[model samples]
Target: MKDHHPHKSLDDVHESVPIHGGKSKFKRVISFFGPAYLISVGYMDPGNWATDLAGGSQFGYALLWVLLMSNVMALLLQSLCTRLGIVRGKDLAQCNREIYPKRMNFVLYVLAELAIAACDLAEVLGMAIGLNLLFGIDILWGVLISFADTFLLLYLQRLGMRKLELFIVGLISLIGMCFLAEMFFAQPELEEVVTGFVPSLPNSAALYIAIGIIGATVMPHNLYLHSALVQTRKIDRDEHGIRKALKYNFFDSAIALNIAFFVNAAILILAASVFHKNGMHNVAELQDAYHLLGTTLGTEWAPKLFAIALILAGQSSTITGTLAGQIVMEGYLQLRISPLLRRMLTRLLAIVPAVIVIIVFGDEKVGQMLIFSQVLLSMQLAFAVIPLIHFVSDKEKMGAFVIGAKIKFFSWLIAVVIAFLNFQLVYEEVTDWLSEIDNVGLQACIVAGALGLFVLLIMTIVYPWILKRKPSRSDIHISFDDLEFKQASSFRTILLALDFSKSDEKVISQVLQYNPAISRLILIHIVESASVKYTGGQSDDYETRKDLARVEQYAKFLKEKGYDVLFELGYNNRIKAIRTMCGKYSADLLIVGSHGHNGLKDIVFGETVNKLRHAVKIPVLIAQ
Candidate 1:
């Protein structure tokens, strides 16, 4: 993980290149390109390879449409992430910390880390299998070799961030070329290949693989990582700059990810063509794919190309995965640690579980475990996606940069679809596995575990909704610590509205007794635009100048007593201003001097004091 300390200032890391105008529009667009590529790598990681392979080999290109749908979702999500980073000047995790309370930040951090660890597990396991396939190395030894790549990442950090990015780009390119060569050797029928892009599930078994493909493609950690990555360049930090960055970042993500789409689609196409077509429908294992690609294609170079691509995919992904882990930890928790220590710790979190799975289940089951790991990722998707939706959709946080109605509709649609599908997949898979077990005690334990997971999944989806549920405005339930004190005031805070009537001075005099208990006060005066306007130094209207003078006199009198006052002037009528002030100030009590009105006259014209008393939940004191 590169040194991305979350609490650090914007100027702490790279000397960001300025994205000012005067360069050609194209050149400015090029400057914002690197962040999206960093994100695009996550889309094509070794985890994706597992699902694509499983989908293709068993389903025979039937899951290609899942890949395509997953990419479109990825593009929309990542583009929102890009805009979030540019507009808020904070990453998703940082925004989470800012918008949410500390408890939620903790929960989000844990889920995000789990997603990263799950992703890392895939990358680490993929590299091991790749090593076992390309060379004669054992899987356990390859898992050990995976840790040494962290040191390589550290070394690359010294060369500069751009160089590290270029290296990953090179790896991406290499992996693409290797697969393109495989496509050449296998020579899939184009007509049949294109049919995969039309949606179909020929087998129910393909459903798990479809879920894995979606989960692996649109990752949780990448959302947090990309929001931070786009801030790498020192953007103009204005309306025009944000517009330009959003435009170009979307382009960068689309272009880079379409390349990823090709790499992913190619893998499936190769699997469908090479293995599924040749009576090898169950070749879901990466090792099996490697072994069969050579014999099936009748070319010695084919399997070698496959193994090399797998190794590159694994190594490249782990680099970014580690970086994302670092970002998640630091951004959510405000944590800072040595990059070396943090990387090893994160890798261990992945390696220990993976090593346990391989040891307990053996090598043959690791392939199934890989696909399961991705499904685990899918389960946690709701937690990450919900908060991201809340953040980008809010007009308050995003300002003019908030997503439009159409984008909001589609983004939410994607979120809801992913969440619903993930929960459904988990439910079906857990119940199916439970039914297979015959031991009563173990079955009870498994059932208990599934119930626990079900509850957790429910909470992950429910928590954001819980946060969004607005606190209802209940009537003030005022009480004192002692019953004897009930006759005394319960008001520690007060809102006093001045109407500048004959009783205004009397109301001011009455507030002295409450001053002993009152710690804060808010004074509001409304100058209705229909009644008065700010008439330069003097007004043609006599009432306007008199009203301004009265407010100033009251303000000066209040200041002389060293009272803490928040004075506000509204351009509306007194009734509306006082009514709104109750909510704005969260007033414990409202005080205003009423114009003594008799029966029919009070009913015909509105009484501001009477109106406020009826409208607000707080007690209103009217001094005549």
Candidate 2:
């Protein structure tokens, strides 16, 4: 005999009407699936394609195992991210700000942002090069053309996020088909391809390429995007719904990633069989591969297939990269730069160097710049991975869904290895550059400077490990119990902010559940601008009517629960209104929903409820 009362359980409202509606069950599922999968594969951008192709062409399938292993690792990490978002109802960037110290959090945010920007540069360059190959446009003109494509992609987003996702899926499928066609035409020797899966490091360069492959596949921005996108689902916090969401998310990620894996493997295997066998070693571009296709396969079909695939690969990656930039900006900074502005920023950063190179040194120099951007990506991987590993491993924070011992150990090991490899890559590049200096005095000066920097690096790494500080009481702030709300005595009033969203309803219900002693409930809905029209006019008469209707509905709902209910309505800027309402109503406890903000604003401003805490000297209860 289950309880029939609404106050006794949340499951009673689990099947309540959703704000967004559709005609069929299948339509609902389809609607939820698009954002996670299409958006996640954006991590596998044009830079990844370049690295995969370069690895196969140079090392002849020796590095194929890296992609296989990295994808598995990526799956585990992304699952943790999705779980974190579902459990906390907040994105990874916001979670980081909560868990880490302010200075450290800001530093991590900057590094992660830089990595995304670098990856975007690579995607833009790849798209330009692909356009040049397919349409016979000049590389410079192609770069500008790719910039134009950004506006078109953002326009599709205005149709709805789902439409944009569907369009990307179509592009990805087309690219996958092109690769499948090439794989069929090339027909690599099966035995050698099978042996490539055994994982052998032939040389230092092969090891480096393997590192690049892993770095390119498991990107930082995808973690942020996937976690944030999962929240768009209408799923409740019920155990059953959570389990189902996780299961579906896993299926969604696996299918999308497997397609990515096939495309990656086909590119590697095709290059290995076609280019590596011949003594012609220095395959610089996709065009270089096209030239070999005609000569090696004894057919014109191979080159044509390669060119078409390259075009698809480049175009698909570009769209995703831009989307990632948007997510990062929105999630970390709590600022929305329109898509066109974001694209222009990315293009200018990538193209300035590329255009200068083509003008002075030629198009060949731009190819080197593309590889340089990939190397830059490899360097920044650790900044994002370390924070993710630390946060997911915190048992108190993540509860039962925290990362297991085995997963934590393996991920940490990978992070350490990647950090070391990035250091070596930076060291080698610097040393090689220094060695090329013709003047002996200048070369000696450069060597001395490098040695000094290396010593500082050694000190920075060792000092933290050797002189660890004892954990102090000052380090602690609010605990879990502190966040839990308690009812004030019967004489006090409680101010609750409502957005008319389901999330707001949850907050109200939570307040009634925990603290039934309230004398009155003051409901607030801030009107941001005076000129901004509501469903009715902005006149006082219309506003008063709207407020009365909302208050009456809430009063009726509370009366059915057998509680004396009273409501008041106010309008102003959200933060300002919260402060004013708190003082005027003399709120014993401020109850507000956590939504609309992310990252640092979520930490400093404290979302909706958390923000009220700093503004007013009162206990703010954040209802998730």
Which one is best on lDDT?
Answer: 1
Model 1: per-residue lDDT, tens digit, 1-624? 111233432223433556646658777777676767777877887778867887888888899999999999999988888887777777777766655656656866887888888888888898999899889888988888898887888788667667777898899889989988998998899999889888888767777778778878888888888887777777666688678778888889999889899999999999899888887878767888888887888998999998888889888888877778777776777666778897898899888887887788788777766867686687677777777877787786688888889998998899988887787777776777778887889879877866765676566556545756433111122234323633665577778888767887777876655664354677777665443444422233555656767777776787677666676665555666678877888989888887778678887966777667788898888877
Assess the local accuracy of residue 127 in candidate 1 as a C-alpha lDDT between 0 and 100.
90
The C-alpha stretches of model 1 lying farther than 4 A from their native spots are 1-15, 20-22, 432-624
Task: Tell how far residue 491 is off in model 1, in angstroms.
Answer: 48
The Cα error of candidate 2 at residue 406, in Å, is 2.2
Error of 2 at 416 (Å): 2.3
lDDT of 2 at 175: 75
Deviating ranges (above 4 Å) for candidate 2: 1-32, 436-624
TM-score, candidate 2, is: 0.66
The sequence of per-residue lDDT tens digits that candidate 2 reaches over residues 200-294 is 99988888778777767777777776666666566756766667677776777777787778888888888887777775555747657767878
What is the alpha-carbon lDDT of model 2 when measured against the actual structure? 0.66
Clashing pairs in 2: none
